[model samples]
Target: MESKTVLYIILASIVALGIVVFQYIYKQKAKSKIYLLLAFLRFIGIFGLLLLLINPQFAQKTYTLEKPNLVILADNSTSVAENGKELNNIISKIKATKELSNRFKITDYKFGSDLNILDSLTFKGKNTNIHNSLSALKDVYAREQMVTLILSDGNQTIGEDYSYFKAERNNTIYSMVLGDTTKYKDISVGPIQTNKYAFLKNKFPLETYVSYQGNTPVSVFVSVKMNGKIVHRENLKLNSDVNFKAISIQVDANSVGIKNLEVKVSPLAEERNIKNNRRSTSIEVIDEKTKIALVSDILHPDLGALKKAIESNEQREVSIFKSSASKNVLEDVDLFIFYQPTAKFKQSFDFAKSKNANTFIITGSQTDYTFINNSNIGIEIENGYPQQEIFGLLNNAFTKYDTASFDLTDFPPLISDAGPILITSPFETLLGTQIKGLNVQQPLLSVIDENSSKRALLLGENLWKWRVQTYRNTNEFINFDEFIGNLIRYLTSSKNKSRLNVDYEKVYQGSSNAVITATYFDEAFLFDQNAKIRIQVTNKEAQKSQTSPMVLKNGYFEADLTNLVAGEYEFIVSVEKESKTAKGTFVISEFDMENQFVSSDNLKMEKLAVNSGGKVFYPSQIEDLINDLSTNKAYVPTEKGTENIVSLIDFKKLLAIIIIAFTAEWFIRKYNGLI
Candidate 1:
């Protein structure tokens, strides 16, 4: 196709012609028509071979008239069909407009918690997530001219806000607002906020957000009911409509185990929506005391701060001692926190190591790396250099526990020896060191999970600086105290001694989805998904039992127990192959989320329509909506062209032609008495 290829083909043809002339005209005695035919066949075969060598290709063009995509995203959640009559009217209107498919490509989808292509709507979805629906549509029809029609009540129960979506300039979104938008007298109790665990004899706080929708001032009575009895009560004066008040209540933890606390605001006489006036949450009250012994080389402020932080939790008791005195205390405590252990503390360290106690070591200038390396700890500090100040940066992938409070953006740096921190065994690093504003690939805080013992390492000292700096910034020690407490809790907690581990909460709200996850480990302590984990659940109140198998996903087994009725429940998780069993109890407290709101969010739907250059319409205005969409200039169909490049050598017919030409020439040569 190019000039260079043409020139090469011409040169090849000339060479073939000279060869044919030499073979037939000069060498052959007979110069008749047969000889000429033979020379011509030879030249033809040579030129055909040269052409095949060129490997020419051509473009195959295709033309098409692509219609604009009309995406109808229908909300199939329960909120959309709260009133069956209104939902039916909307569906009937959508079906009546099916004739629009004649000019546009119609694509129907249904969205609740997940987005899916719709065969039909059943309106059985439990949660509504409008954001996921539109985002999924945007990803699927990214390059197509699309006009989306969203029909919903616009009550999103989960995921991010849908108003933040940036729709394409050419694309349009028309929303059909559903349900009643008129204001209704209502009182609702929002989510409960409280600590997950409480100590016996200590009082824990419960905070709830109470909202009201009424014009007149009302005296709302907030009460905490435990075990079906009122434990605490208070009254608040709500002055205006659309106002929210935060109420805090404290309850004494008189006994251990899981305690279900119900917080409710007594509804007004005229309030019609009373289903959301109450909320329930549970907390575990434990009596076990985790005794920790702090072993230090010398008396320092860092040591004292660490002791205070660990002891802040009522369940934890920290005893500080010099390295010489630590050996005597190591036998009495469950965990050892060694601060800057030097040669003098070698005997105490060996005693703790021999006892197989959970240990957390903090390294500093006085830390003897040689002595630490000789120990069976999972990490070894190599090429030790001068001490340096390094800030802490959270490792995002750490899955040991909730790391949301590990944010250290404004926190000061800690002092540690500068060098590569080497990890020798299987471990997880929670924090990495950052030097001079650049993240370095060195673990600042890490956990080592060994079969025999659980160990943790903090590759720095001067932890007192964090407490001081945090207090200076926020006028509180919440960050540093929580961080240190969480670290100690993680280090001191018992290791996964069992091959099968079930992770779940003690209780869950009835209206919310309940999920329990389990991990199965083989004899080698490796995650084994094929171990076959199954759970036997029993309603403790009714004595009804059922068994279900957990599905394996991403090296973990997950069981969804969301549809269970409100009652006290117990579950026994068993691994079929391992013959290991774990039992746990949880209560599903009654709470109806569907009845929280009685009206649709028409404002959200209006904003979605306006932002996408479209109009919002009610179910009765469907015909007008259809007319507007059909007349829009940008929504019309457009011609599209597609081109494909195909190589000539790839065609089987061309190969057959080449074979036939070579065969026929050979036959003609043989018949003409030419070899």
Candidate 2:
């Protein structure tokens, strides 16, 4: 309380005493025992009422003992369930230990595909993500002095490696292995890499690793099969020192549609697990091809580079033609590459507009800006004197398609006419211009879609230099070629030109849920938030079908196919009140990630323990772990104190006392006929 409040309280008491003396002694002039009692009552009532008006406050201090957090994370994946009996014993002992229960607050969780409070364990999770679980706990107990205990087989099938995870300085992590440690003779095939889309009549490459675990020299045959027929085969010899072999083979995409392929390795005679000896994957064989017409007024090396890059994919063909001959080839072309277009190319642009075909416009010194602007191509450039060399800076916000595969940081600059460019149409800039180490916020490559026609604008020439630089850095042309191919694919793709666009993957792992997303647009091309979307899924093998509504989330309509069984599925996404619909197919492989391991990864568990300032123990040594935690000096309880100010007027007991005093005084007066 402040000095002013103390002064007010003292004055209130003195005033109360004076008022009581004046009433009982001065005014009444009576000397009796009753008079003394009346004076005391009056003094208390006046003081209490004055004190309420003053509202004096008092300080209070409170102390509490905050217990440290003890988090127990257990593996609920099927791979660790083999040692469930031992795991249960360890958990029971920890729970029954009074030392730990009194020393810290205990929280139990079981994790596999997700983390959940410990109620019971079914051990049916298809995947294990140890890193994700640990990351979540780090955030939840960031401020608490926490000690984490994990029980798992260390067979992480998904997410990044947990051995590299960094724990908080105030927190410690201990791991307990919970599977067989004995190594057995095993041969497995895994980690198959292949493209999801293949061109018909073309051969696609598939790479896989065959691993063996045994001391004896063994010979096995790795084979690729399609529709129960062997397409390719190879023989491999392995010993204890050389137990791993990488097998790469190309299989013909003979037919169209979805093709399911299986890769198998001959298992050892005494192999304990054969579930991992074979892997299945799916690839879609597309028969549709795109034809591109590249028309230019002058011959340049960029023309050759663009043609080579765009034609790298077997599904696309690029034909070069002079500006005068562009009109004859525009009839059958799906896309037009207008390179440094001049007045002579006016008819080609008009033809492309009439056919509603997509075009990739490349501008340079020879570009006729007046003709281009008059052609109504949604862009206008004011040509200036000297040419500017601008480097490409990738735009991270570009959403039309993915450009993650391109590394534009060290690319060579392109030559363009020095000018101030203006684009009236709304466009997604794929690459912005950077001149002399400064970002100019100008578009180097942009895409626009209007009137159902898609067009891409490149504000410079000499793209061949970028391709050459990419090849020099990466020692391959695939990266640069794929980058150009993606742009061409985007321009020629018919799906983006539609009002309803759907996106999904062609292949998914059975351990994870498959998701299909869609976007609906109004007549003005704005996102329609009120649109309702639905999907109908049919299993190709099982011949069963189901329909479900897609929920709107974060501006996209999504459907989760978590309940679908592992097989090939075909789905159709449609809008409820509109005729817009999209059809696609996907395959879910029945590959259980958790079941791929035959023994616990003890090395990883040990590394994780050492990195987190803890120890690794097995189920039998859990008692020692408990004792260590109990004696650890860093995991002690902390003393927490809090101070609060409480007002005296807020007390109900004070009010009760005032009421009682007044009542007593009234009764005395009434009994003495002084009412």
Candidate 3:
């Protein structure tokens, strides 16, 4: 239909011309001689071969350029909580980008630990993992021509490691710093209380960690105030990155009936925020009392020591019944302390069983081992022989620090323990090992549930002597007073509630929806009670709150919080009832926004344009980029080696040419005396 002068086309045209001339001469021939026939054959062969070489090409290039897609990912992480509404304003600007639609398709990503395109938003995660976000975007659109524009503060959380980015010289990272880089001092309270329960009217130790950031030095006020009264206060001055700057507070666990305790820290005037400077924890104190019974064999120095130790416990009543006393005393006791208490075995065991009293056995020279194992109690000390006086575990907890307080180095030791690791039948173990008769670990401490329901403490060796030794740590309790005080407190402690802990790994941009979960272990936390949960946020101008579900499984309730903004948010759960009030707190964080900053680096948005024969532009250079794209400024010319698949679509011209070629070839063959 149309002609162009290129190498292959010119050669094809010449061959067509030669075939036409010969065909015309052949057609003018009058006779059908042998030479005519031969000439006609040659003409047919040449024209047919040339016709196959009539190469034609068709193409339509629309010299139009489009504005590449522009994704302006905004950071919504908590780190930027100080920036006020600057970030929101920027996000709004990009969201209303309809004017740039022809030149660029803009997507708004509001991210923290991960990336989430903004819509009428509802809930999102806390934390900032920007590196992960951009990496994820890159993986999704590796073949696309898109430009990623990052607007954030310089404090990066995730991305290529700093070393990797610098090592690889990934210069594609275009940063539009948002927050003012001016250093402003800030102090925060991170670590809080570890234990949830304590004895009423007693001192409870709480650990809190404080941190200071920025270039300048700053002073902060730390206080433990209860019901608006200042109980404890400390003034501290801190420099940047100083570790171990912590404060410990020993607050009185308000008497047995009090339930709420508030601990607050005073932030400096120049501080970033104040909500995190204070927190409140709820607790209940146990004051239930009990009565104890003390049983000893001889009036040795050890018996006197035992009496004093058992007397310190207000709940325990020690009645020393020497074996020689008249057997006419009627006893109603809760616990029994047997110091070499092996006597006319039948009577003693019967009284212990009748009173539902737990027995604590201490072996000595007059002990009869043969019938003891048959009575069902204590660890089996088969090698009743003397052993080395070396230190080991007290129970299951290992004591790494040694002190002369419990000076057992003079006597052969029996596994170096004062409590139990085993238990016996017909009785429940309160602490330590159970009695196997022939062994030493029979209820180191136990509870008998028969009649009076009493408990016992079995001092395996002579611990009264160690209370008189000297050492720095536990040695302070080197006297029977402090030592026994610790003992009584341990025995009378309550075991009621179970602690609820929620743990999960954080996922950002490069993450899939992992199982966000919570599990419970405290039995006191009743799943049946509608436990209400409220999430508190401090990142934005207006604090946001969300209620979590009460989905219970195996005594634990779960609520999956996925697709959340990157930042940190705290969840507060409260259970209100007629007789009990319980509360728990947990935190969930995402570094997606911080990581998006990192991920955005590896994504070569400008390179995509460069590779696909396009130019790059900034917000101000959009017009020029468009103008160049509309012309031949950036389109790379095609190569000649790969043009075999050209096709021409002109039905009329093709049909006429086919008919003319056939007729011309026929006439030329006849005229040339070939046919």
Number of backbone-clashing residue pairs for each candidate, in the order shown: 0, 0, 92
| Candidates sorted on TM-score, descending | 1, 2, 3
What TM-score would each prediction reach against the true structure? 0.67, 0.67, 0.45
Task: Give the alpha carbon lDDT tens digit for every residue of 1-675 in model 1.
Answer: 457766877888898898888888888877788778777877777766776787666678898888888888888887666655676566566656755665688878888889998887788777888888898888888888888888888888888898666798657899988888888877888899888888898999988888877788888889888777889888878767537888777889999988888888998897767778888888888888898888886777898788778878878888887888745556778888888887788777788878888899888887888877777676678745887889888988998777787557577788888478787887998898899889888888988877767788898888888888888888888887898888778777775378888998777876357888999888898998678889999998899998999999887999999878887889999988566999998878776555578688989898998898888998888788878877767777787789887775654665566577668778988896777
The runs of at least 3 residues in candidate 2 whose Cα sits more than 4 Å from the true structure, single-residue gaps closed, are: 1-12, 19-46, 49-67, 96-104, 291-450, 454-496, 511-513, 622-644, 651-675
How many clashes (backbone atoms < 3 Å, residues ≥3 apart in a chain or on different chains) does model 3 have? 92
Top model number, lDDT: 2
- Return whichever of 1 and 3 wins on lDDT: 1
Indicate the residue-level lDDT of 475 in model 1.
88
Instruction: Estimate the overall C-alpha local distance difference test score of candidate 1.
Output: 0.81
1 against 2, candidate with superior lDDT: 2
**Whole-model lDDT, candidate 2?**
0.88
lDDT of 2 by residue, 1-675 (tens): 778899999999999999999999999999999989989998999899898889998788899999999999989888877787777778888988999999989989999978889898778777899999999999999998898999999999889999999999978999998888789988999778999898898999999899989899999999998867899898999989999999888889999988778899988888888988999888889887788999987999999999999888878888988877845556788999999998988787788888888999999988888888888777988875588889989988999989987887578889998477788987889999999999988889999977668899999989999889888998989888998998998888864357899899998867266899999999998999899899999998888999999999998899999777789999999998799999998998777777778789999999998998999999878779999999988888989999899885755877888889989999999999876
What's the TM for model 2?
0.67
Q: Which scores higher on TM-score, 2 or 3?
A: 2
Which candidate, 2 or 3, would have the higher lDDT against the true structure?
2
